[model samples]
Target: MSGRILIVDDDPVQRRLLEEAVTRFGYSSRVVENGVEALQVLRAPEGGDIDLVILDLVMPELDGYAVLEKMRGDGNSTPVIVQTAQAGIDTVVGAMRAGAQDFVVKPIGPERLEVSIRNVLKVSALEDEIVRFRKSAAGTLTFSDIITRSPSMERVIRLGERAASSHIPILIEGESGVGKELIARAIQGQSDRAAKPFVTVNCGAIPENLVESILFGHEKGAFTGAVDKHVGKFQEAHGGTLFLDEVGELPLDVQVKLLRALQEGEIDPVGARRPQKIDFRLISATNRRLMDLVKEGRFREDLYYRLNVFPIWIPPLRDRLEDIPELTRHFLARFAAEEHKSKVSTVAPETVALLQSYDWPGNIRQLENAVFRAVVLCDDTCLRPDDFPQVQANCASRGAGGGQGGEPRIDAPLIAGEPAIRPDDAAGERSGEHAGAAALWKAQGSFAGFTDGSVPFGFLRALDRNGHVQTLECVERDMIVTAIDHYGGRMAEVARRLGIGRSTLYRKLKDYGLEASNGQDAAE
Candidate 1:
């Protein structure tokens, strides 16, 4: 009732009737003459914001079903109510299958349409509210802002929650960048002792001679550096939680003292006659296999059993690459403010593709760092591959190292919302190697126009050095053909990423004699 309604119909009388109904419902309306025109209007930048669409069943060029199919295929979830003269069950079922929220029989009643629209809008609002509450609940339950929908992470979080309320020592195992400490902190934060201090100690970073003093504290004049009494991490974490990161790195001698502390809630200070009593919830994390270390006598078997009461393994980022987009958007919002560049906060589709392509060896931390770096370097309102020089350089080096099947494509030109034309392909890659495809693809489809607009330095020098020159028409033609190859001919995304209207993008595809992926000439 508060948003614009799109009325798409071929009949002038029917269109006017629907528009009037829509306006009377306390909403603004737009009237399109046909389904083909409706898609054009919907794919525009403003089209993304349309609240709902009322599509007629019959139309020339494209029908309501076809439009629904296309919209669904493009990942657009805009609510739609399909209107048809035929009240056949089959038509309604087909419309539903194509993602129509509801169907209306023609000779439209104002009450019926009003009821359906209100119901659909009510459902949408409810779904949004549910999502908002779920996010709030996730934050409160986990004591974390780590965003993920990965099934593996969901299981880990659930397990960590149960582990939090108990007094058992928790052992967290995973790769270095897999966010083990976050899990430990979540447990600490959600525990009964949440108000108490939660201390962390890196076992591997401590000097070999100071291990005992660091973990158990020392009395004044305990050793050469004992001019004053020192409080250790374990003492600091008394009545709270102690997170021992890299716990496997503890020396064999220190393992014995740690095992004693777990066996008896007490620790002996260096050069002290009495052992001090302490109560702490222990959570240990390591990137290494502690069982193997125990087998090698580097860790005490008794200590291992004591610490392994609750085991939680955090899955690596590679195992959950599906979460990258969500994580990227979250990081972009955060880093954009930190960098003071709001315009460059949003990433182009090509940047996402490139990010998804890489095997993130350093995991989430690395991805966040890379995004931050790209945000700092971003010169335009949107982030592009050019902004991530380190990532590009890394891919280039990997390609140079020679990979299987063929040489790696380090500098392939990536058209946004497209598959990717190979580096060796003459269509788009070569032209975009220096300036990047976003720059070349953004042009009114010409090399001169690309270079003429602004001398971004890198692309121009690379072009001049490479001795690559081209005419106006070929630039546009090649761009269209190359875009089809890269995107597998997904015209909607190609148009969106190429910064051109869908109609304009399609006409150029027709002019170029290339549109379909089967390599057929579009003019035919």
Candidate 2:
């Protein structure tokens, strides 16, 4: 909070007066006779703690402009305020162009000088805050730590690494909870500006009316809530990256403003007379297909193109099933550490297989929740199948045979609408058929075709062959069943584990008919 002010002036009286004024304002001040002395002071580590430089434009040797240029060229960002007797519009412009923050007429009043110093320092403080915020936020990113061995996910990881190394705008596309933001963070970590700010704003979270102000800032009195000047994400992310999560959710009007900012490298804070120049890298992520949205006229094509300069598609967890074991272990470790319980470690192979078999509708987020639930419920060192009751239930319902032993083939569906459950007549007829023929035909088509013959095997096989197989509903059902089993029939536990409120989970359960209990085991 304490700042040092350096006064560089040839006029002895002016220097003394300014120093006295600065001292009264609770700031320590140092006086140098000319720019030469100021430069020397700045170059020397032991000279003084100089936070702001009040320099006179005209000096004998090494004038203020030359000193300013030198400091900037040397990459010094110390705020400079120019004070001169021969002050004109051209002189003010010249000082600013030379990197001086502000200009003041030489016959300066004590109050005006103090105000200028306070204003400059205030701006500097904001800039410092922005830098601090970015560093802290960037450090919070642990995306690369996401353990995944799947080739699909490995490609995403490689893309994330490349994106992180550059300031080019990156757009991450995938299903919700697929770790789009994680990819964004990973990119930030690999970037040259890693040490600077990395800020994230959920485009969908902000109200449509206020998103523009949130992205580009607003001048005081810009709108109804504009009681104070607010710094937008662009300004806050100066010299760093700004991640717009769910950018596809951003309203069209705001999209235009955002596109302008990205293209022009400047932003007009609402109600401001002039646009402020900014330097920042844009990173956007969305669960929605932005290109599809653009074609549907829901999102702007221009904005999409601008944001899509570097597109990274994060494959859904289903597509990267091979990574489940690694991701499960990672989340388990994370939750154990977070919960301060080192005793909890290792998951049963049966449990791992159950997780791998699951179609993660919520993607990495759902997997994380499942692991966290297991960690909380698991009292032993090894996570048993019972630790993930919901997952077990889902596997059982799917007739995937939960656990390694494969219990007596229960006809119960692991999840509602699971294709594994067929009519008694259908099962009886299939019993006579050769197992190899059944396996071959079943393996050749979609999972949906394995149950009801009503689903065309040819169509399902075509889809499976093309690799556009899994349905979102199927994934959702699996996720729902997994959550339920993890909670041991406790709706509250299921909701908490899945990161949704209990009421929401109940609604989903009812919608999916997952709330239907067998009614055989009540008190057990």
Candidate 3:
């Protein structure tokens, strides 16, 4: 509540108004005339001290959208609310799309302005709490358990902690399979309301017509399927946390109702005469670009602001491979314990290196699944590379030939192909000369078998060493391709074998460069 508020606008009067509003709420405020000035302040050594930004959409030097874009692009997650004298659907949509937390049209009324500021501040506090919780739980949670150690992830954890501590609404953004729901749970677990029920409702999974009833509890005769009184997620999570997963999937009407609930802290049960008050923390997650949806006129701008009081983003796995070793160990331990098996306790160091090399499009969940699969199929005390056949096959197909880190080293021989020259062989032969190259190749892989027409055992050995480390995307792509080829390119069979939707398979095929004929080819 005592945080600094940055006012960014070309108009002095508007800045004064916002300053007064912020001061009235007992917060310190500063005014900047344009995005350039704001960036100057933000980039200062002490710039990060500014807690929230009240940005103006239209300014002389740099507009509000440009300011938001610069801040977000630089990895600054400071909460932002945009204000503009010109009010229009396009303006509101553009502001939100630019990553503004909320948008306020010009001629700002004191009440509306105060409410927006308070909402954004409340959410910021919650995000701070999430960060604290994550830092505290770092060692306890495995990389596979949480999946990120990047600066971005650390910031998200902190923000999530803050969100969990406050009663304000929260919005989490990321791509599909980025573990948005997991972050929501972590927030709930760290909140004061952890003792109470933690309810989750997938907006995308519910029918459009029934979404309201699902969210607002219904009377026995509320609808055709309402045979008895039913409690909605909000009511069920009373005195606790209510997680709205895939919130962007909600219809415009439902979003409006949801906004009302956030504003009033109450809900009106279907077929009921009176509204019932509910005390619950609202946490929402979405993979879709909600601001884009707003720009396309598919989402309400007001609702977007209401839900995004506090926004947290979870980064994809490729950006944070440093955490893979910890994640792999974590998942292996979890699955081993769950299955009451001691044989699958540890992974080979080479396997860890292999996994660290690949990109994890499916993030933590995919890693967990792969570990579980390996555990289930292992026949010996030590889980080896062959235990994860799909992963090894995929790595082999990549022409990696082998190495510990993500990239294949030049020294490694092609085990599946004819033997080739290895760096180690040359290094030993020319001990006095080319020492650096020999060492580099040796550290990367021993190139012994390549010169002799026979493939080196090190190639297979490297695969055996680092098999556990292949990322979920690589493994999944390899599995899908294998299934497709095995089934003679039968789409339906491939989907069934992969345990995914046909549509999902098609999408994966396109993503992995397998859909060459569908005009969805992957970029070269």
Query: Which is the leading candidate under lDDT?
Result: 1
Higher-TM-score candidate of 1 and 2: 1
Q: Candidate 1: lDDT of 227?
A: 98
lDDT: worst 10-residue window of model 2:
422-431
* Candidate 2 lDDT tens digits, 40-84: 889897343577999999999889899999999877788999988
- The TM-score obtained by model 3 is 0.50
Minimum summed lDDT over a 10-residue window in model 1 is located at 424-433
**Tens digits of per-residue lDDT for model 3, 1-524:** 33568999888888888888778655678888889999999989657667789888888878888889999898888899888778889888888888888888888888788777756654554455455446434412222235444677878887877776687788888866677877877776676765567788987667667888989989998778789998888899898778898777677787887888988999988887889999988888886678877887767899999888888888877677766655665566556666877545455555666676555545666666777888898876545677766556545644455532222344534544534433221100111232223332343354433343333222322232344444667646645654454344556434544544354666688778877743322221
Instruction: Tell me, by TM-score, which candidate is best.
Output: 1
| CA-lDDT, candidates in order | 0.71, 0.69, 0.67
TM-scores of all models?
Answer: 0.52, 0.51, 0.50
RMSD of each: 21.4, 22.2, 22.6
* Candidate numbers, best lDDT first, in rank order: 1, 2, 3
